[model samples]
Target: MSAAAVAEQDGRTGPLERPAGRTCRLCGSNQLRRFLDLGVVPRCELFLTPEAVAAPDVSYPLQVWVCERCLLVQLPPLFTPEETFTDYPYFSSYSTSRVEQARTLVEDAVRRLGLGLDSFVVEVGSNDGYLLQHLVRRWIRCLGIEPSVNVGETAREKGAPTFTEFLTAETGALVRAIHGPADLVIANYVYGDVPDVTDFTRGLRSLVADDGWASIEVQHLLTLVERTEFDTIYHEHFQYFTLLTGQRALATGGLSVVDVELVDIRGGAIRIWARPTECAMEPSVRVTEVLAAEEAAGLHVARGHDGFAEAVSRVRDDLVSFLIEARRAGKKVVGYGASGNGNTLLNYCGVRPDLLAYTVDRNPYKHGRYTPGTRIPVHAPERIAADRPDYVLVLPWNLRAELLDQLSYVREWGGKLVFPIPELEVVSPAPADRPLEHPVF
Candidate 1:
């Protein structure tokens, strides 16, 4: 039986709720082939408290599949949008690197699009007004549509007009009616979280002006499979897109890609510049180049999804062995970055408080809470200095450089860093005599 059929037999909703069989979200194709199954995992962002941990925590199957028709990588809808993002704890402004990326994008958009005081910019899923706040500072008219009430309020406080509502076709029409069509629509890192990809793209088409363009950034599927980025495979991310699948998803909503840029953020990301289908603008050479690269990487076929299960299994076994050896050697191992990806990795590997003593995060909201499923206590960065662990497991390995620089003090005590993903390896601290080697894990 298919995964969806199994889910239905177990009285659960599968990834695609279809009558006949599971269908692709982008293209209504039921030829989905299951690739990797990460077992049941809780929502990555759902951090628990001491009281909540004592109670039952919910979890769902974290399986991934690739559509034969469009080759879109996706997970079944294990949780509703309201369940995942209503009072979300993640804030984009909390990370200096993320904030800088947003500011840089805003500067480029303003210059490239000739955005003036009259230009209206609308950002879908604008968390804490990180990007739109830059526009507000330049005295430009802007609006943010954030579903999370807490993050929306923060955006409002930062002087960016925000609507705490999920962006749907209806919401898009409503925004267009009130603020008129947007000159520039930004959907940074929000595309993957959208459950209904078709409706979200339609909303984008509705909210954007005829001449306006939409900029979307989604983690690349090539990077996910090649780098064995299993930690990013959480219930919150409904679909993983390659340039081919991304173009297919956008085309369903009367949008066409004009340019595509490969970025290093979020491990590996593709920034797509799309315009209305009716627009006569030809796609830039960059778009063709990216599509070619995806084709060469076997992303357009089922082969691209192959070997992923084995890769994830190897990482899991290696990590578990590394942790076991560390504990056996009388070393204290703790984690840094109490992030959603960290939660996924910890829960997948079944690493409990016994294996990973604790973790520290800069986000004040998660300081006193515990990680979902694993129930590892989260403390502030200052706690790291007090404990002085022998090995600090860098959970959010994507931000290794920034985190390494921030926690370099661990080097003073001869503490080393551990990266679980890509491979299990221990990174030695930089010698006091010279600059850090910055070893690539």
Candidate 2:
């Protein structure tokens, strides 16, 4: 989810509206404490066109609470899958880096799992068949289970056969009828977004072959708080998982982690490889180490909510001051990446077009559209070269390295790019100078 404040066009859920007192969605803890109240925010994915900007829009509460019971951080309930996914507009192929990552992951799965021509691959939330497109190249058989009609249709059009519906136990049975069993399954970034983790994993179990493996990538919870990734908290992401909690969730669904890989992609990510408990792949020492660390930190204990609330306040104030100071200096500042994280950052900080000129995104669908709430217009990356502003404010700071490399020309005229959250800083490259190392946090 790119940081931005807009409604997710697919089937978005409705607000919980159960009058505050919410038990922790993960561990059944009533000791839930409120930390950040982003007011009512629209789905962060729903970018409005310039014309639609004039129309009134819907908004929902974006409050986040930490469960003392499970140390699980989550947003207050808002929007159902029907409201979020049914009309989803996001296409996975929009990002080159994402496509590359998908391709690489598919390759790794094939090699690690000994997948061959006879193997079957099933993907959950497989938008536009981004990874399947590569799997097909290897002459592998594949099926994509996508809930969104628009994206599923595109995946089918791309030649990877698809089921244009969400994966559930029922859907899994239907897929089993047609595809038999999948030798490999992928749930990249899907597990956390799903509310019914048990059902979703049940569907996965039904689809996977008896000895097959499934790889799920989720944002590592430790990394989220350690890095001050408040922007990652949004309505769509249901449960933040560390290896400890994730293993528990998977075990409940009759799966076990056989291996784990910490990836730098998506800020910080963990790709867990799992199979039936009968499978004998040895769990890595890293797994126990991570689980132990989480236990010591009381991830399952309900306490320390107030400290997090204070941290949220500190981050919010610092971000606001950074943007305000930049604007007061008469510097021309624009945002980079209109992703959902950027939206949460902007809205939470109360930033509007008054501070940022506009946002730049590589995704064409967002270009020329207005960011929800702030009315900041989204434009193509070329706008940076053409406009050549004094400063560029990066919303998806996790990708600052990639964006900086891509927009190195900003240094041609001494233009520097700014990072907001975590901390604020500028990167100015001399025309003939090599890349500079960002100050290590």
| lDDT digits (tens) for residues 1-441 of candidate 2 | 521212134322222122355776666767665555667777788889877998886888887666655566676556677777876767878777788899899888877878889989988989888988998999999988888887888888889888888888788878988879888889988888877777887888888778888889999876776667878877788787888778878876688997888888777889988998787478988777777766676554434333454566787787677667767777788878898888888877888898899989887878788887778999888888898887788888887566767778887866777776565566674444353333211
Q: Give the C-alpha lDDT of model 1.
A: 0.86
Off by over 4 Å in 1: 1-20, 429-441
lDDT of 1 at 353: 89
lDDT per prediction? 0.86, 0.77
Candidate 2: regions farther than 4 A off: 1-21, 24-29, 280-282, 296-300, 304-306, 429-441
Worst window of 10 by summed lDDT in candidate 2: 10-19
- TM-score per candidate: 0.92, 0.88
Clashing pairs in 1: 15-76
Evaluated with TM-score, which candidate comes out highest? 1
TM-score, cand. 2: 0.88
